[model samples]
Target: MDTIAVDPDLYAAQSAYAPDDWQSETTSIRSSIYRGLMDNGRRIPSDEQQFETYEAGHLVDLILDSDRDNPLFRSPIGADRERPLQVLDIGTGKGTWAIDVADMFPNATVRGVDLFPPPVTWMPPNCVIEVDDVLQDWTWRERFDLIHMRNMIGSFDNAEWDRVYEQCFEKMAPGGWIEQLEVGPFITSDDNSLPEDSALASWGPILQKCGDRAGRPCDIVLTMPQSIKNAGFVDVHEKVYKWPIGPWPRDQKFKEAGMVNSQHWMSGMEGWCMWLLTKYGDPEPWTKDEVHVFCAKLRNELKNPHYHAYHKA
Candidate 1:
């Protein structure tokens, strides 16, 4: 089996944090301490940075806000009185959404299904994290009232998504709701602000190719709304939000989040690129030292009030 090592230059370029946040600790993705971990097999500024709600509360809130109709816990879509709803959160990364849902709807039973165990800090009275792949040929005997899937673009294909939706449709009670959220990777700004030849633009095609080579179609975001409609769903609605990648926005809150996100991006770049190269050529063409320097420059630019990048999902 081929395995990749965490690049030392990439790790060293991370933004300095408080001693408490930067404690010299090592944990695998299987561990609870590594909650909110995302591995697309790359080394970027934020590659190893755990995305717990505690560390990124505002970003989590912003993401959840878009799913107000069929929230992780609350069955606001078609709630009934005198019934305790059952909800399923697919790909429940970090269990932040699951935790919030459990707290929001005390009466509901929320189940989070992911490949790994739940983090220790993810405990909530009404929530349970089950170790399972949502794509597996499994049956729930039509048990859940609401199903929610978020951020599974890079991890699943259309066939898998269709099957999962079909399963959800069967499992959901009559008049139940299934909500899906995904970030579109191949995004281009109508404005020339995002140079057509930039990393963000190139990332989409490379990722798409990688997914294709791996036997999974990665471009799902552009087709999610259509997929939902095809999955026998009603009231299919879609909304788009621009998440700034750097502190370039006018809003103070957005700028702050973007700044942090930019640094995180800077920290994780080489890991990401190196992984891509391994899957696709010789990283010798791109020195690890050059990657570190570029990431450092990106991080500094993120602090500039004028620097801006958007996260369109």
Candidate 2:
């Protein structure tokens, strides 16, 4: 639900694509939520609502806490109060990190950048947001003490990511930290809950194929760590978190978040898949009925909690 604002001319030109022509698809589809809201006689929340719903989860809080406690972030920035420390969150959807970090470090200024208009709003004096694609060429007159990119795999190609990291390196101050959080689409669990043919297993291959056909490989989850290190960041660290999809978790908080994420992701899966099928003329293999059933099955599988990590640089 990110509304991308491009130059008028560029936006007009791209708008010519039929509904079926856009190749890239969002991994989560909220149509089901919309339907659920409608069926329950409740209004569906806007992009802002969706963002807040996801951000309210404890998983994000845990991630932020871990990062704040990490040795790299604990390094002192000296007693220089005249110049505030700068941090950038790339592809920042809800600006959760910017808000949390600003609150955590009152002396630091944070900026969130994304291709779409940020769905959430806040007036924290220390936080700002810019609407633009980070993959595009940009000129920043200032350097940052920290650069963070999370969940950008589905949106940017591998080559584009390399370029983004290069830009981040150039914009980072000496002794700065760059953290990239990504997940391998290939899923795994110690509980042996996921079947071999599950979307968790098939997502990587399907997404890779779709990206290949589009001439932009969007699968960067597995390669982000090396990519960041290659961009010249020192004292890199990586941490992984397992996100449960549904209420099958033993932990109450995790179970709640998993149920929410599962509901969001499963409802959105069709739109994600359709964007590709409609583009590649491949809907024959996955009829609308099959797609719905698959999403339901995937949602049911979310009971097992599992995810990977690529937090580094």
Candidate 3:
């Protein structure tokens, strides 16, 4: 469902892969939720329906950080607003975050790069949402003041991840900052509202194993701290949040965040799981129908009000 725009001249001159020769075998007609790019090995959806899901995720992020002065990002880059800053957003799905940041820092140049261009019609003069694969050599002339990535958990393997972080370090200005946010795949309840024996409870380990089997590890949320440090970044700051799954939280902000996040999961889960489960399910590869049936059960569990399910971020 995702559409990528590759520059033909750039591809021909800089790489061996052609645009048309660039299809992934992971696409399944039976699973309407997903298509893959062999380049990033990513199956994040991009249709109108799925774009709504990504928009919901962007809203959830805003609601969670609403109390902060600048919820767009935590990097301390734009303290002197008049001073021109360069910012790069890797994996900029939907481009809402990049657009907001551009507005926030009108003098700054904000570049939102992704394998697929965001489904946005218009952007601010300071914002540029371009299609790019970051694994290749970065061609930008100016170094970035801030480099940010979010929801990029399963996009790369270990070596590729090191390369990405290294690129982040190399492309950044001398005192630049890098921030990444990822959510845990596990759904958990503190008061045992959801039983451990339930199929929904097994969601974490199931996909974790599937990701491992597929060679793109999905445990980036847990391992990112050390990995970032290993990439030569210092003065690392970490923040964690317990993101409630449904509108079950008593606090007003969390309840609102949960409501948005519920839709996020409802819309994005099928696409997220299709490639991993169908290609690397336990016992054997599962059929696309089986993946859809399992996602339906998960959705039902998410809709249960009594179950206070949440995943760590």
Clashing pairs in 3: none
lDDT of 2 by residue, 241-307 (tens): 5654443444444433444444445444565555554454233445666666766665444433332
Tell me the deviation in Å of residue 298 in model 2.
2.3
Error of 2 at 304 (Å): 9.1
Q: Candidate 3 regions off by >4 Å? A: 1-47
TM-score to native of every candidate shown: 0.69, 0.67, 0.84
- Specify the highest-TM-score model's number: 3
How many residue pairs clash in model 1?
16
The 0-to-1 C-alpha lDDT of every candidate, in the order given, reads: 0.55, 0.54, 0.76
- A best-first ranking of the candidates according to their lDDT comes to 3, 1, 2
CA RMSD per model (angstroms): 10.1, 13.1, 14.1
Cα lDDT over the full model 3? 0.76
TM-score of 3: 0.84
lDDT value, residue 301 of candidate 2: 48
